[model samples]
Target: MEKADPVLERLEGQIAWYDRRSQYSQRWFKWLKGAVLVAAAAIPFLAGIEAPRLLIGGLGALIVVLEGLQQLNQYQHNWITYRSTCEALKHEKYLYLANAGPYASAQDPRALLAERVESLVSQEHARWVSAREEAKKTLEKLGP
Candidate 1:
C-alpha cells in the first residue's frame, strides 16, 4: 500500500474542515432567520388573541435578540470567507500536484504550495479579525 503524501493529506483535511464549518454555519443561519421571522410575525397574532402584554413583548424581544446574535456572529460572512479560502487552497494543491500554472516553474513545489495555503488561511484570519472588530463597533452603537 502506497503511503499518502503528508502535504496532500493535510491540505485535504483543512479543506474538509472548512467545508464542514461553512455548511454548519449556513444551516444554522437559515434556521435562525426562519425562527426570528416566525416569532416576529406571530406577535401581531398573539396580540390579536389578547395574549398577555408580557407574552407579546417577549416575542418582540426574542426577534431583536435573535437578529442581534446573527449580526454579531456573522456566520454567513464566515461561511463564505472560509469556503473561499478552502477553494483557493485546493486550487493551489491541485496546481502543485499537476505541476501546472505558477507551480510549474517552482524548484520546490511542495514548499511553494505550503506557503500559498498558509497565505490563504492567514488572509481568512485577517478578514475574521476585521469583521469581529466591525461587529463590535456596530454593537457599541447599539448602546449595550
Candidate 2:
C-alpha cells in the first residue's frame, strides 16, 4: 500500500480551488462584457428609431455602470493571476511527485514543496499589487 502524503493532498486542494475561482471570474467577465457591448450597439438603433430619450439614456447609463463594475471587480486581472498561480502550484506538485528539478535529493521534500508554494503565491500577490499601482498612475496621468 502506498502512503498518502498530506502535503501533496493539500497542494492538490489549493490548486483545484484556484482553478475554479479563475474560471468563475473569467466567465463573469465575459458575460458582463458581452452584455455591455450589446447594449452599447443598440443605442444607435434606438436613436435612429426615435426611441424615448429616457430609454437611450438608460442604456448609456447601464453600459457605464457595467464597465465600472468590471473595473472595480478586476475580473480579468484576478482570473489571470489565479490561473497563473494555479499553474505554478501544479508545476511544483508535479516536480515533487516525480522527484525531479529542485525536489530531487531534497532532505525534507514536504518542507521544500511548502516553501515553493508560498514563494509562488507571494510573487503573484506582489505582481498584482504592482500592476494595480501602475494602473492607478496611468489613470492619474490621463486625468479625471
TM-score for each prediction?
0.88, 0.83
lDDT of 1 by residue, 1-144 (tens): 998887778788889988898898888789889999899889999999999999999998999988998999998898888888788878887788799998899898888878787778788899999999999999999995
Error of 1 at 65 (Å): 1.2
CA lDDT, candidate 2, residue 1: 100
Candidate of highest TM-score: 1
Model 2: which ten-residue window has the lowest total lDDT? 134-143
Q: Any residue pairs clashing in model 1, and if so which?
A: none
RMSD to truth, every model: 1.8, 2.8
Against the unseen true structure, what C-alpha lDDT does each candidate score?
0.87, 0.88
